[model samples]
Target: MSSKARHSLDPLNLDRFNHEALIPLVSPLTGKNYIGWCNHIELLLTATVKLDFITGKCERPTERAKAEQWDLVDSMVRSLILGSVSKEIAQHFIHAKTAKSLWEEIKGRYGSHGPLLYRIHRKLRSIRQGNADLFEYYSKLCNLWSELHYLKPIPVCKCKCNVGKEISVGECNGCILAKQIADDKSETELFQFLMGLNDCYDNVRDLILLMEPLPTPSKAYSMLLGVETMRELSKGEKGCEKTHDLVCSYCKKIGHTHEGCFKLHPKTKRSM
Candidate 1:
C-alpha cells in the first residue's frame, strides 16, 4: 500500500476520515481483525450523525438545515430543567424554534414577581450538559413552584369568637384549623370544603340574626355540628379566639396575620 493508503488504513485516523471514505477503507479488514478494532466505528458514526441531527447540525433536511444548532441545544437544556411531566410538555420544548421563544414561554407562565423568575433564569443559564441531571431536577422544581403559586389557600369561616357574627365572606381561626387538618386532601376536596362552609355560614347567619340573643358555641363544637346543623342554627355563633394571632385584619382570614395578607386589595383597594 502507498503511504496515503497505509495512513488511511490506520484505526487511529478514523477521526480524520470523511464519511464517504470510511466504508471503502474498512472493506479490506474483515473477520476478527476488523471486528475487534473497527466493528464499533460504523455504529459510532451513526450515533454522531444522529446527535448532529438532533442538535440541528446535520447538513440534510433542507427546511431545518438553516436552523441554528444552539437554539435546539438551549431548548433541550430548558426542557430538562423545567421537567416535562407529560408528552405535551416535552413537545413544547422539542418543537420550539428558538431559545428566545422557549424563554418567553417560561417567563409568561412562571414570572409574576420579577425576582423569583430572574433567579430561576440565572440558575438555568449556569447549567451545562455535564450537569444535565441537576438541570432536570431543577426543571421539576420549577414546575412544582409554579403549581404551588396558583394553589388557592383553603377558605375558612369569617366570624369572630368575641363578636359571634358571621359575614358573607370571612375567614376565621376554625376555618384555618380545618384547612390544616385537610392539608392532605386533594385540591378538589379542599375547594368543596370551602364552598360548603360558605353556603352553610350564609344560611345560618340569616336564621341566627332573627333570633333574640345570639347563641355561642366553641369552634370545635361548631365544626362537628356538620354543615346541615350549622346552616340551620337559629341563634348561635362560634368563636375562634384561640387563633387570634393567626387572624388577618385586612382580609379577615386566619392562618395569616394582617402583615401576611397577599391580596392586592388587602383592606381598601391598596396593595399589601
Candidate 2:
C-alpha cells in the first residue's frame, strides 16, 4: 500500500496531528465534517489539560472560549498603556511647544555673556522706544559696549570754532568736516588745520572731497604731500618744524601749540 493509504489508517499519527496538519489528511472529507472534528478535538484537549491542572473538573468549552477572548482584550489594553507611557517619556525631553521657553532653557545651560546680554538689552530698549529698526542701533551699541568692556578710552579732539568747543570723543570727523565747509576759510588753511587734527588720513581725504567747492588738484596734491611729510617728521624725536611753527604763531595756547590744545584755553593776561 502507498504511504498516504497507510497513514490514513494509522490512528497514532492522526492522534498527534494538529489542526493545521490535519487539514491535508482530511481534505477528502466534507468541509462540515472536518470543521466538526477540529472543534471536537480542540475542546477535548483543552478540557483534559484543565482537568489535570485542577481537581479533575474540566472547564466547559464555553468558559474556555470566554477566557481566551478576555486574554486577547487584556493584551491589547496593556500594549496601548505602554505606548502612551513611552510617548509621555519622550515628550519630557523634546518639547514641541513654544520657542521662548526653549531659548531660556538653552541660555540657562550655557551662561549668558556680556555681549549677548548687551545685545538683548539694546533690542529691548529699541522695542520700548518704538524703533522697529534694531539693526541700525545694534552696531553702535556693540561698538560702545566692546570699548567699555576693553577699558579702551576714546580721546576727544577739540575744534577751534565756538560751536565745536564742547567736543566729545569720536567727534573728530564731524569737526574737521564742519571747519572745511565754512566759506570764511581758505582751502589751504582748512586743509592744514585738518591735518593738525587727530582724525585719520582717510577721514581727512573724504572730508576734503566732500567740500562744497571741491579743492583743486594742486591743493589736494599739496595737502597730500603736507600730511605725508608731517606723518614722517612726527615719527622722530623732533616734530615737523613747519607745522610746529605755524601752530605756535597762530594758536592761542602758550606752553604747547594749537595741535595739542584741547580748546583755546582762556587767553592769559600778562602780569607786570
Candidate 3:
C-alpha cells in the first residue's frame, strides 16, 4: 500500500492544521522582490504535499465523490498560499482556479527577467565588509553566490573517461562546460571577496595574490580568518592587560581606581 493509503485511512484533520504557524510573512512582490517570497511559498506547499494534499496542476478526480474532496483540499492549499501574500500580490492570482495555477501565475509574473539579475549583480559588486563581522561578510557573499548559482545551475560531467585519473583523456561537453563556468565564477568571487577586505588585510591579500598559484576562495577565506582571529586574540590580551594595570584605592580592584570606585563613596553622586 502507498503511504497516502495509510494517511487516508488514519486521516488527520486538515482543518485543525494551523497553516499560519510556520508560514512566514512574504512581503508583496513588486516584481523585483520575489525570490524570498517564492522560497516561503515553496516550503508551505511542500508541507501540504507531505500531508497528501495536491497543489500542482488541476487534475480530474477519477471518482465523483473524490472530486468534492479534491476541491476542498485545493481550496485549503490555495488559501494557505494566498494568505501569506499581500492583497496586491494576491489580486493578480485571484482568478486562478487551482493552487497550481495560482503558483504558476505568480512565478510567471515575477520569477523571470533581466532586472532581477542586474540588481543581484549590482548588489554583489557593491558589497563591502567594512566594520562588519568576517564570517557574516563571507556568508553574505556565499548567499549571493547561491542565488546566482540557482539562476545558472552548475553543469555535471557525463563522459565515461578515466574516472580515477587527474586528467580525463576525453573531457566531454559537460565536463568542459562545468569547468569553464566554475573557473570564471571562482575568479570573479575571489576578486569580490578581496575587494571587500579592510585596509588592515591589504598586505596579506597582496601576498595571497603574489603566490606561485593563487589560492582558492575558501583558502583565501582561511588565511583572512587566521589574521582576523589573531587580531581579535591580540585585542583581548591588550584588554586583559589594561584591566590588570588598573588599581582602585578603595578595594584595590583591577578594573577601577579611587575616583571611579563605587565602594569608596557608596552614597556620593561621584560613586560609579
Candidate 4:
C-alpha cells in the first residue's frame, strides 16, 4: 500500500546490494564522531532507498507475506547499522530487532552532546591561520563550517521561491530580497575567514571588502590567491636577478665570486 511496500517486493534490490564495497571508511559511532558517522551512513541509506527503514516512516503490513518481505529489508538496513559502528556498539544494539529502534537507541546514546556544540563554536571563533598556507587554513575553516552547519541546519523555504531554484544572477529578480538575505548569512563566514588571514594580506582584504556588490568567500579566496601568487613570483624574480649578478674573480665563472671559487679552494670556498 505504501512506497516501501512496493519497494520491498523487489528482490533485485537485495540481490544487487553490495555492503562490503560500498561501506565508507568513516569513524566508528562509538567514538566522538557521531556527526560524521551519522551523516555518512544516512547518505548511504538514502542512496540505497532504505532511509525509511531507519526513519520509521513506513508501517509494517498486516499480510504475513508482505510483513516477511518488510522484515527482510529491515534486516538488510540493520546490518548496515551494525557494520558501521564499533563491535562494542554493535553488540550493545544486537537486540534492537528493527532498524528504526537501533538507530534511535544509538542516537539517544551519543547524539545529544551539549559540550560538543559549544566546543565547535569556540574553535570556530578562535581559529587563526598562523603558519598554515591559505589553502590549508581555508580547508580547516570549511570543514568546521560543514560540521557546524550539520548541527544547526540553515532554515530556507523553497516553496514558490525563485531563489531556491537554479535561476541565474539577474534572472532571480522576483526573489532578489530573499537571495540577498541568504547571501548576507554567508558574510559571517567571509568576514571570519578574512579576519583569520595573515596581516600581510590586510591591503588585499580591504580591497576585496571595498567591492560594490561584495564577493563570496570563494571569490575572495581566488582574489587573495592571485595576490599571493604575484608576491611569490616577484620574490622569485628578484632572487633570480641577484643570482645572475654573481661572478667569480678567480674562476671567471658567472655563478661564483672570487672568494667563493671552488677551483681556488677545493675543500673550502670563499666569496670576493
Candidate 5:
C-alpha cells in the first residue's frame, strides 16, 4: 500500500472522515466571537476527554507504542480544532504540529484577562431587560456570568474542618468570597434591570428597596414581573369600564335610563 493511503487508515486520522461526520460545524472563532465560540469548543473538548483524546492517557506501553499513540491523539485533536475555525484563522496556524500549540496560539492572540474583565463589566452595565422579553434578558445576563466565571473561576477550599466532619455551610473561605461577590453583583444587576423597567414600575421598585432585607435579584425580578402583570390587568379593566359607563347627555349622570332622560323622552322632560 502507498504510504499516503496507509496514513489515511490510521485509527487516529480524523481527517479521513468528512468534516461534518466527526464533529458538527460551528462558526469560526474570530476575535469578535471568541468568547461564545471558545465556550462551545471547550465543552466539546471536555466531552472528548473520556475518549482518551484530550490527555492521551495510556495505562502501560512500550517506548515506541506510547509515542505513536500520543502522536495519533494529537493529530486528531488538531484536525478537530482546525476544522471548527474559519479558513483565515486556520491558515495562520496551518503549520501547527500539535493541539496544545494551536490552542496557545489562539489564546495568546485573542484572550486577555484584563480586557475581558473590562468588557464583561461594560456589558453588565449596559444590559437592560427593557422592551425585550424577560427570559431573554435573564439569559443574556446569565451568559455573561458564565463567561466571567470561566475567566475567573471561584476557588474551592480544600482544608478539612473539625477533622473529617463535613464543614458547615458558609464557613469556608471560598463560600465567603463567593457570597460577597454574589451580593455585590446582585446590587448592580438588580439596578440595571430596574432601570429598564417601564415608568409604571417606579413605585414598585421603590417599595422593594424600602423593605427590611431587600429582595434578592431573583425575587426582585419576580416582583417586577408581578407588577407588570397587574398593570396590564388594570389597563384591561379600565378599558372595560370605559365601555360600560354610559353618561346621558341630558341627565349628565352615568347609568341614566331612557325613562330618566329628558332629551329622549319629551314627556318626562324636567325644568332646566
Candidate 6:
C-alpha cells in the first residue's frame, strides 16, 4: 500500500489520539459534572471507532492472540477514562479490569437518574430573561436544553416511508411544530423563550404574537434587538463607536474601514 493509503487505514493509531485535545475539557472532570464530561468522552470514543471497547459491545476473543489485542485496546480506553477525570476520582477506578467497569463505576456513583433529571428540569423552568440581555438569556436556556437532550436523547424516527411532500411551514411560529410533534404546549422552545422575557418587552412580544405565524425565537430575538437599539437611542444611549478599530485596506490606516476608505470610494469622496 502507498504511504497515504497505509495512513488512512490506521486512522485510529492510538498514539495519535491526544486525550485532552480530543475531549476539550475546561478542567478535569469533577464528580458534579459527570454528565457533561461523559457526553464529551462518548463523542470522542464514537468518532474514533473505539466506543465498543468501552461500551462492552466488543467482547474479548477466546483465541489467545486476539484476546491479547483486546486487552491492549481495553487498557488504552481505560487510560483515556483516567486521563479525563480528576486525580482523586481516578484513584478509585484505576484498578478496574475493563474500561466498561470503570465507566459503569463512575456512572453508578454520580449518574443517579431520578434526582439529577428532576433538578435539571426544575432548573430549566427557573431560567428567565429578567435583568439580562436577550442574547445572554437565549444562550443560557439553549445550553441547558442541549445538556438535557444529551442525557436523555429523544428516539429517532427511522420510518421507511418518506412523507413524500415536505411538511414545512411557519416553524417560526411560537411552537406550532412543538404542539404537533410533541403534542405538548410546554415542550415549545418558542413559547418558553417568549414567556421568559421581562415586562418591558410586552409591546414587542405582542407584535411578535400578532403575526400570522409567530416569528421563531431567533427571528423574534433579531426583532427585539432592533427594539432594544431604538430604546437605547431614544434614551440618548449611543453605543460605542470603534472608529479607530477600523482599518482602510487601500491606505492601511485607522479611522476608516475598507468599504469607507477614501481611496476605494474615490467618486463618492469627490461627491462629498
What range of 10 consecutive residues in model 4 has the weakest lDDT sum?
Answer: 238-247
lDDT tens per residue, model 4, 181-258: 567757888998999987766656766787767888888888776656644554554212223334455754333445
Better of 1 and 3 by TM-score: 3
Model 3, runs deviating above 4 Å:
1-18, 25-32, 47-58, 157-171, 211-216, 237-272
lDDT per residue as tens, model 3, 171-249: 7776676677777778888888999876666656676777656677888898767655554554564212222233454
Candidate that beats the other on TM-score, 2 or 6, i.e. the better one: 6
Query: Order the candidates by lDDT, highest first — what do you get?
Result: 4, 6, 3, 5, 1, 2
Which candidate number has the best lDDT? 4
Each candidate: RMSD to true structure?
A: 25.8, 36.3, 12.5, 11.4, 13.1, 10.2
Runs of candidate 4 with Cα error greater than 4 angstroms are 1-12, 162-181, 237-272
- TM-scores, each model vs. reference: 0.18, 0.17, 0.65, 0.72, 0.65, 0.68
lDDT string, candidate 5, 61-136, tens digits = 4578666776766777778778888888888988986677777788788788888889988988777756666557
Clashes of each: 5, 0, 0, 5, 0, 0
Q: Write the per-residue lDDT of candidate 1 for residues 10-84, one digit (tens) a residue.
A: 332333424444433333322212222122333434433323322334333245533344344344433432332
Instruction: Single out the weakest 10-residue window by summed lDDT for candidate 1.
Output: 29-38
Candidate 6 regions exceeding 4 Å error are 1-16, 20-26, 162-179, 182-187, 229-272
Clashes of 5: 0
**Pairs clashing within candidate 1:** 81-139, 82-139, 158-170, 161-239, 215-235
Task: Write the candidate numbers in order of decreasing TM-score.
Answer: 4, 6, 3, 5, 1, 2
lDDT (0 to 1) per candidate: 0.38, 0.37, 0.65, 0.72, 0.63, 0.67
**Tens-place lDDT digits, model 2, residues 1-272:** 99976755432222332433323332221221222232333343343221111122322235775656534433332232222223433244244222223223333433235554565445434432123222333334444334333332233345444344533323468565544443233453344433433333344456466766877534654654564455556555233333433222244322344544445434342221
lDDT score at residue 90, model 2, on the 0-100 scale: 27
lDDT of 1: 0.38
The CA-based lDDT of model 2 is what? 0.37
